[model samples]
Each structure stands twice: as structure tokens, then as C-alpha cells.
Target: MVAVRDYKTALEYVQTFEEKDGLSAEQLMDSSVRGGLTYNDFLILPGKIEYPSSTVTLTTKLTRNITLNAPLVSSPMDTVTESEMAIHMALLGGIGIIHHNCSPEDQAEMVKKVKTYENGFINSPFVIGPNTTVAEARGLKEELGFSGYPVTETGDLSGKLLGLITSRDIQFVEDDTLLVSQLMSKNPVTAKHGITLLEGNEILKETKKGKLLIVDDEGKLISMLSRADLMKNQNYPLASKSATTKQLLCGAAIGTIEADKYRLQLLVEAGLDVVVIDSSQGNSIYQLDMIKHIKENYPKLEIIAGNVVTREQAASLIAAGADALRIGMGSGSICITQEVMACGRPQGTAVYQVSKFANEFGVPTMADGGVQNIGHIVKAIALGASTVMMGGMLAGTTEAPGEYFFRDGQRLKMYRGMGSIDAMKKTDKKANASTSRYFSESDKVLVAQGVSGSVVDKGSIKKFLPYLYNGLQHSCQDIGVISTAILRQEVDNGNVRFEFRTASAQLEGGINNLHSYEKRLHD
Candidate 1:
């Protein structure tokens, strides 16, 4: 019998040029002496495009142990990430870190929600009691954005199975007080709780039902599988999931304080796949001790430590067993850390220096902050970061935590940095995420390192992420690299080129001469 290799393994190694058109990554970093370069300070030189953008692969590692189909991560900000954002981020081939600005129990609940969110099944689905009125069900439908719900004895997953309620039952009910038990479909088909997704799909197809409830031997509800979710599984081919559990990977942020030890324990129990040791400056002893403690206790958990901008900081975290490093300081769009503290390297330079050093220790780095568009993402990869952590770029999306409001006839959502006063004030005083991040919780006075603002509404992650993914693919294709791995290799080999953009060149590259125009990214 003949053996065949997978398509990824069979892919041919593309050629690279010896005589490059512009400065190499190393040269660019070295030449940036007076002040480090930002994304806008330089531009990547395009390579020969030989294949369609759709053919470009973007699989990369977020850490030494965790790999993602896409090199994207949502920042752990109060207004940017929550259970909703984390779930969608994982389903779209990336991960979101749940912010720790809230109570530990609340944060843990958010992590649990992401872990329990199955691709074809709702593990901890919304449930209603038999006595629930038609009006209440309609209100729930509007809140949850779903029409069908499993009806249980006690209105929750812990109760015994009763029946199922759907939009069809309450659509035209004249009486607002009509009970769910009266209109729910009786004797619904269900399977044992431990059935595989394939088996559930088969049962749903055979029974011609829209949902398949999983229950225990005593007829207690365990989960609900939906046909819509099955369709979504087919649609999202690049979803990031764990191989062993077949669940979407989830992450959460935690401070480096003594109290956070308990927070980490709760998060770990909730099936957290990764933990980011969130800090504005990550080189202190607190973070080092926290990293060592976590490594010793939870050997299986991957840790991404830092908001560091130097090689020295990366070395310390890597020594303390960090699997990945977050490289950026004072570079976030809403952050003013450099101005307030007068201590931070330029983002482009910071990413290059730390990522290069971390690579020596077999550690990946996340370029956090200052990512404005798809081009910036490509630039970070070229500079050696394996993934990019987005804050302002991803804020204002439908999934991001916050309600959208109209301002000046434009829809907008709140976006605030963790170090912003508003965010600090919103956090629990005993467990303030902002003060802990800046290592100033014990200070007599509170200081702000970031600002609060709002961003134009950017619709849903379902629509927004695909645009980013395709844009990244097209960018890699233009750079003549078929995969993210090769993109880094080409940059290292000086095959991919870069050039410093003058101020005039920056203006020239944009819509300079256009009188006025509406910029639409995706429909």
C-alpha cells in the first residue's frame, strides 16, 4: 500500500529572492535609532503574487503549546472582551481573553460560558420553566436572540426535562399570561447526554427535528443541540478548537497580585485554555513569582506574560516559564502610558526586539496594541510576532461587551483601556484590574495611563472577522508567502523587504486627493 501526505505537508517551498528591493527587518530595526518606527513609519514591499489569495494559509502558533488557525487575539479590556466576544473569537479561528475587571466569580462564569459553548451543542443553554408566561418567553427571545429553548421543571439546566418551547408556540398568542406548558411541543425526541456530534446529527436528520436535547438517565437536561449550529460548523471551517476535547479554546486575563492566585484557581477549574498575566509593565517580581507559581501548579496551562517592550523583560518572563510574551507598552490607541510615565519603546521596535529574543528560547510573542488595520497585522508578522492582540481595532463590534448608541447620527460603542480612570473606577476596589496592571494599587493617589472613548459601530464578528482573515490571506499572498510560518521565514531570510515611509509618502499612500468619500470595508 502507498502512503500519502497531507496537503499542508505536500506544499512546495516557494522561492525567495537574494537581491531584495528594500531594507531587511534587522536593518530597519537597526536604522531606527533616533526614534523607533511605528506601523505608519514603514511599509512592506510587495512580492510577486503567484497564487490566489484564497489559497494562502494562515495557521500559526499563539504560544509554544497552543496553535490557532488565525493569528488574531482580542485584548482583555472591560469594554472589549467578555463571554460573548471570547466565544465568537474562538469560533472564528482566534481567542479572546476575558477581562478580570469584574468579580472573580463573574469572570469565572464568563470563562465557563466560553468553555461550555459547543459548536453543535449548547452545553449550558438558556432554559425556561413550565409556568413561564408567553410574555416572559417573548422577552427572553429578544434578550437571548434565540427562539427555541428547552423547558425544564425548575427553569434551568439542573432540573428534569419537560419539553421544548419555540417561536412558533408564542408567535400569535393573544393572552400574555399563557403558560409555556400549555403551548410547548410535548414528548420531544432526546438522546443520551454522552452522544457524539456525529450521532446527534444523525438522530436529528432521522427524526427531522430542528433540535436534539441530551438528557441523563433520570431525564434531566444536559444540553441542547441545534440544526443551526450544525450549519455553522460547516460554514466556519477555520474555527480554533482543542483536539482532545473538540471544544473552542478559551483564555482569560489575571493580575499578578496575591489575590489573583485564587482567581487563577477558579479560572483553571472553569476550563481556561490559556492565561494572560495582564500588566502594563511585566518585569517586576510580582509577575515573575506569579508565573513560576502557575507553572509549578498547573503544568498543562499555557501562560502569556507581559506588556513588555524590551529584551530584558522578555528574558525574565521566558525564564519564569512563560510560553508566550505580549510585546507592547504605551502603544495602544487610547493609552498614554508613555506620556504619563515617560517609559516605553515605539511599538514597531518593541515587537521586533522582543520577538527576536523570544524566538531564541522557542517562545512566540503577541504584538499587542497599535494595530489599526490589516496592513498593520502583516507588518507585525514581518517583524517576528506570531500573533497580534487587538483592542481598539476589534472594539465597537457587535460581540464586544457594551450597548450601541447613536451619536451624531452614527452608531457607536464604548472602548476604554484597562488603565483608563473610567475602567479603574468600574472595577471592584479590592480587585481593581487597572491599578493591578500598573502595579500601583497601593499608591496613595490614583493615576490614569489611558483614556476613555468610543468607536464607530463595526457590526458583528461574524462579518468583521472574515474580512480580516481574507485580508490577511491576500496580504501574505502579495508578500509571496503562502503561510504565516513562511512569512516569518522569508522576513528572517531578508527575502521579504521593507522601506521607511516619509511623511509625504504616508499622505501619498492614503486617499490624499479625494475631496470627500465614504470608506466602506465590507458589506
Candidate 2:
């Protein structure tokens, strides 16, 4: 069975004039590329990792403080951007733009979820004097949800940090009465205040530890680094840079009719980055008035206005001091604003128009819907969208809150639309054109459409994020763009080509007529 020639030579020998003249891609339908089908004839997209390698900075400068890793964002939908999802996204280095389809308190809980998942705050981390007991450390971890403690010489950390104690370091002790000093990690790796993050990473990697202690000039314990803190913005993992500001950035969705000031203030205190003044019909006096009020009072807080579909609407929000814009008009899978009332633009075109104008004023635009997969993400980025807001796709995940229940022999989460019937009380939340107005006075409960519902399987965002990250990396690798900025540049510079496709061709190729290999390894 040994071959006399290599693959290239063997292929040349196997080629027959009959095969070339008589066959097409359609004829082979198996292993060949078939008739003029080039990689350019179809679009391969980027996921989260394949960022442009040209060193174009992608820092989401918010409130002069917090910076995110990837500019890519998950949409704030009822079933998508929840507490679990937010924390995982943050862990994976992207931001989970939490949805606000629920009550104000619930939304606040979502914020707390991200900050609390794993953190190193100025206050309230596990702290203990050098002479504490291992039993005490174990108790602290079990009860308070903190797994380890920073050991300082004085209770106030005024002296040098003596060492550190973790549950694993203490678990095998013969005596529960053993002192923490007996088991503590002594003279643990420490970082000076001005050290680079890259240097910090190396120290952590060398020591094989979760965090490092930050010390002042005199070796006074200044702060602690949580393992979670060290892992952020995975896309553009930083070597190191000191954050001059302490502000945390978050995005919120507010109603145009009754966005409460008290709630707004609470969000500002909770580290809200931008306020998305959400509305079905955003070009009205009601939304404009709300924008004016927010700008007047919370002058320092960044406000992003939207659901706007045109240049004029985008213009109005921009003029009202919008820090960013959300562009889409009835593109949502569950939205019926356009169908029932006959208003709104095609989302693709809407993104183009709004993003074009919004970019002119330095306000970033988020393409809000119609993102069924990673391709939509790439397309939105190419069309000048600063980011994408996904809902249905990201839903049913751990960060997306829900209890799993049996449905059609599978576990799933409740995934539904906002303007959906569940969102509408059969009466009040119901849409009435008399209640619905497009460019004028209107009604129809205007929302009354089919109460269609779908169920999705519940899972954690951790697994899902890696899929996106790898997918984006492979996409960029194929296109020869190492970064998102570069990919966009290639697309804009005509270095990219787009090809529309149908399901048949996509599925027809690859190993066919193979055995089913019916076997269950795990199940």
C-alpha cells in the first residue's frame, strides 16, 4: 500500500481529461471545491480573540476609569445578560451588558453579581493578623465566601506583609489549633505600586499563585490582587498599566417615560458607565425630554440614547449629550413594533445610517439586533458598529438567570422577547396603537401580536465564551487580520469580500456516505 509518489504527483497522475471535461463542483459533490468556488465566495467571520495585531488600542474609556478587554458586548436582553453571564463575560475578558427588562432592584442585583463574583476591593476582603489560626481562616472562607486571607504584621497592615494563608495551605494540618503562621505562605511574592501588569503576570506565573500583594514604597501593604483581578479583558491581555481612576463602568437601560432620578443616582453610585434611554419610538418629545432631564441633573454620568433607526434620531440623541447610541428598529426576533404599526427601518441599513452619523460625533454605536451568530457580529463590526448587543443567542447561559425545566425531552431556559406577551400584561403591558404612536398620536396596545415562546437549555457563560473566542480567532486567522481594528480596516479598504450563501451548499460537502458510527461513549 506504499505510494510511489507524494500527494501532488499522485493527484496529477489520477487526473483524466474525461473527469475534467465531464465534471463540475456539482458533479463531484464530495471532495472537490467544484467550479470556481473560492474562499472569497463566502464570508468567514471573526470571534472575540482574533483581534488586529497592529497594536490599535481597544480601551473602552468610560467615566475616566474602568477599561474592558474586548469592545465586543452581549446584549442586555431578558434571557441573555444576567448576573451569571455578566461575571463569566468579565472573567473571559468581555463585558456582559446586563439586560434591564426586569425590575430596578433585579437590575441592581445583576450589577452586584459581577462585582461580587470574585473581587479585590479597598474594603472587606479576607484580612488577618500574622498570628491567626488556620481554623479561623477556614471558617472565614466557608462563611463569608472568601477563600483566602492576606496576612499582615499589624492588624492595620502598617508593617510588612508577613505572609498569606489559603484553605488548601491549611487543610492537611493535624491540629485545628495550628497557628496560621505555621502554614502561611511566607514572604509571598509582592509587587511595588508602579510595577507593570506584565511583570506582575510573570511573578504570578513563576510563583504559581492566584494573587500578589501590592506594597507602598516602605513595603506597607497598599492593596491586594484577587486572581479575578489579574484575569481581565482576555482579548488584549495587558502587560501592565496603573489605573489612575477608580470608577467602574456599567451600561443601563432606562424607559423614556418614567426613568426615575432616584434609580439613576443609585446606578451612578453602583458604578454605572452609561445610561441607555430605551424606547420603542425614540424620536419623540418624551424621549428627548427625558434625555434633557438626565443631562441636566446627572451631568457627569454618561448617557447613551437609542432604539433610534435613522440619522435624525441618532442626531437628536447625540445633541442631547448621548455618550453612545443603540441603532435598530424592530429587528429583534420578538419585536413587532414595525409589523403592527408599519414603522422602523431594516436593521442592516439602520446600523449603517445611525453608526455613520454617530461616529462623526465620537459617539460609539451598538448594532442592537438580528445577530443570529458570530457572522452577524463580524458584519456589524464591519458596518461601523462599535459593538454588538446579542440576546437570544447568549440566553440560556449561566449568566442568563433561569431555572432549568424539562421540555421535549431536554433541559432549557425560558427565552422570550420583551415586547413579548409575557412582558405585556394581557391588558396593561398589551400594545395598543392608541397606546402606540409613530410620529404622532397612536394605539393598538400596538404590541398585541402572537405570544410565541421558545425554550433554551440552561448552561454557564464560561463554556459559551470560549466558543466565541476561538471562533473569532479562527476567523481572523483565515482573513489574515490579527485584530478587530485590522479586520475592519481590511473590510473598509476593500481587502475583504462578501458572498451570500444558502444552507444546501454549506451542508453538501465534507465526508458524506459515511457510517453513522452509532455509539454512546458517555450517555
Candidate 3:
């Protein structure tokens, strides 16, 4: 025979308890019995969940001027980011920083590719000459991964469109010597170039064609719209785009040397939106000078500076007009800088300290390395990182540079740190990314701070990124935070709580005493 308490009585009783379950961010980060802390050293306490996980907002700032729908950034590693990776990342609501491990012309071309990328429109569609053989068109289909090509007299965009060719037109043709002009469809449906995307969609639906060519008054093709692109647009509604051009945002890394100034001019001409002053140690006079120079010369380009891990380093870059700070040193999966140099801070402490300071200036901070999973990304944001930069995490994806190789019956791809000896030796001093970052291009002997390795194939980023986004959204829901901005605000006000985990507590939090297990992150 027990009596249940009324709702008012239960509420009052719960309110009377003054002690909380966990520590505040100030209490957790300020208490330094140990030297430094990492993401595994703590956990965030769960709060009341009143909304659905699908409703959580993951939007955050990439720099002082750039806001993204997602807080994920691909690192500026040669194997991690190129034009392909940059285009897809911007489409998925994050941004990629193109690496400068190639010639200036090549890097600028990559930047141009990203700048010209449109979601539903294929600008500069591939064209073929009317005399092109069936065998050559098949070879092109295999190489370009697409089947349709517009036939032109000059085999380029400058020529007038004569006809169109598709896979279905030649699938059953037995003669390999047949010319495209013999099998092409003449007078394909088309619209004027000035038509809106909605009108283009209507024309495509009404005509029931796989592609709709937009042409000028002279009948020269301006662009092509594909049904596949339309599907992609519907799938990714939160795509990150420029407010003016509606083009995908693009960023590229540049060295701090005087020669880089000329390289940067070419990139600026290619429509680079942001420039990351790539450096291993960003507090040097060289980096500060470069920051100020870029600020004075390229006044409109947003700058993200540093591979810094301390408040002092962050302050110098921010004062020199860095719109954003890249935190973490020697914390990458492939990096051995902490072991060889012994001068870097632990990632969790570094992010918390620098982000806490940068927030005062309204400057955002990017936690640059050592993030292995969604939980690590959540912890980084909880500690105050505005975004997380990943290299290895994104290296093996389909969009990343490099072809897949098989070993031991498992698919793998190359993954390396910028400090690796292999990376430094891959290129000469003219355009080498690793040697320039290490400031040892002139040194007779090169020391390695990172290793070259391979990661298991992570498949296409199209499937992978949505998985990460959904996982992050659910994590935020479990924490009772609907948005990253509010989460940080609650942390500052001492409402969101944290708890330092002991070594045994960390072990207990994971699977224990398991003989065998299979972990599947996504389908």
C-alpha cells in the first residue's frame, strides 16, 4: 500500500536537489591535475530530450564570413581533397580546401572547376565530332563514366550542336567502325539558355528525355541538364552555395613564402573564396607577415590560419586578420609529430582553450585532427570547436584522389599525412606541399613527422556524408540540444554539463569481454 506523489510534489522534490550529475565546462577544462586531455578523457552528460533527432540543426560557421549547413571540413591533404572532393563536399553542405601539392596552374584549374560547378546544370558538357567512331565513343563512355555526348562539327563547346548520342543508340550496333553521325538523333529537344531551372525541369518532364540541352540563339549548346542531376538536387536540399553566384564555395591552401603570392593571384583569378595559410607551426613571423599581406592585397578573401594548439598562437593569427583558426598539432592519425617533436598539446584541451578564446572575437575555430568517429566530432563541438577538419577520415572515400587497390581480399586506398617523408619526396621544391609546410625544402636531410599508409575503402561520399550528418543530428538530440549554437551557449551558461572519465570508466563505456563482434556503421 504505497501512495504515488502528485506531479507538483514530484517537481518540487526534484527541484530541491541542488547538486548536479556532472561538472561544468569551466570546471572540467580548468582542473588540470594531469598535463592535457583528449576526447577519450571525458564524456558529456545527457539532458532532457523533447524533440525528434531529425529536427536537430548542425549548421555552424566555417570562418567569420562563411556559414555552412554542416560542420565538417575535409583537410587540405593531397590525397584527401582535389576538385572532385571539393565539389562533393560543398554539395553536401561542407567545404574542402584544395591542396597545393601540384603546379600552380594545376591548382588554379582545380579551383576553377569547383567555382564553375553547378548542381542541376552540366556546364561545358562533353562533345564529340560527327566523324567520331563508335569504338572511340565507347572508350570515352568508359573513361568519363557517362554515355551521352553532343555531336558538333568542331568536337568542342564552341561549335554548333548538330545532334546528340546516347548509350541506347549504339548498345546493339555490331559495327565498331560506324560514325556517330550515322546513329545520332537529329534535332533533339532543346530550350533557350535563359530559361529558369523550373522551366527546364518542366520541359524535361514534358519531353520525357534523359537530358535537355540549353542552347543560344545560334543553336550552340550553353549547358546540359540531366535527370540524374535533378535527383541529386532533390536529395541534397541543404547544399552549401554562394548567395550571389549560387556556385559551390571553394578554398585552397597556399604556402607562406614570397613565391606563394604569385600563386595566390592565379587562384584568386580562379574565384577562390578562401585561402588557408598552410603551416605546421603558424606562430612564426613568416605566417604573420603572409596573413597581413593577404589581408592588405586580397581584401575580400577570407583567411583560415594555423596548425596552432595554444591561446598565444591563436591570438597572433587572429590579430593578423585570420578569420578562422585551425587547432590541433601532431594529433592526426598518420602523424608522429608528438613523438618526434614533443611540443604539441592534447587535442581536447587545445580545442577547448583556443575555441573559448577565439569565440570572444567572434572568430571560429576548426579542430583540425584526431577525430576518428561521430562521437569524437560531437565531443569537439561540445568543447567549443566550430568545425572539425578530417584527413584520414575522408581519405579513402570515392571522391578522394587515388584509385582503389585490393590487398588480402580487402579494398584499400592510399592515406598519408602531409609530414610523411613519402609526401615530401614526391615533389620538388617548386610545388612541394610537405617540404614547404615543414620549412625544410633547403635542408640536406629531411626528417619524417608522419607515416604513409592505407585505409579501408569507405565507398562513395554521397552515402557516407549523409550517414555522418544523421548520426550527428541524433547525438545532438540525445544531448537535448537542437542546434550547435545553442549547445555552445548552454555550455557557457553552465547548463550543459561534462564529466571527466577515468581509464577504467572509458573501458567500461566500450564493449568488454566480447569474443567476436562485427561493427557496421551504415548500410
- Extract clashing residue pairs from model 3: none
Worst 10 residues of 1 by lDDT: 9-18
* TM-score-sorted candidate list, best first: 3, 1, 2
* lDDT for each residue of candidate 2 in 330-394, tens digit (9 for 90 to 100): 77776676787687776655775577677778787777877766656666665667767777777
The CA lDDT at 448 in model 2 is 47
- What RMSD value applies to candidate 3? 3.8
Q: lDDT of candidate 1 vs native? A: 0.90
Please give me the total number of clashing residue pairs in predicted model 3: 0
Per-candidate RMSD vs. true structure?
Answer: 7.3, 10.0, 3.8
Off by over 4 Å in 3: 1-8, 17-20, 31-35, 112-118, 126-195, 213-224, 269-271, 403-411
Give the candidates in order of lDDT, highest first. Answer: 1, 3, 2
C-alpha RMSD between model 2 and the true structure: 10.0
Task: Tell me which of candidates 2 and 3 scores higher on TM-score.
Answer: 3
User: Which lDDT tens digits does candidate 1 get at residues 267-366?
Assistant: 9998899999999999999999999899899999999999899999888899889999999999999999999999998899999989999998999999
lDDT (10s digit) by residue, model 3, range 406-514? 9999999999988898889887563488888888777788888899999999988988899999999998888889998888888888888998999999999998899
Most lDDT-accurate candidate: 1
Full-model lDDT for every candidate: 0.90, 0.60, 0.89
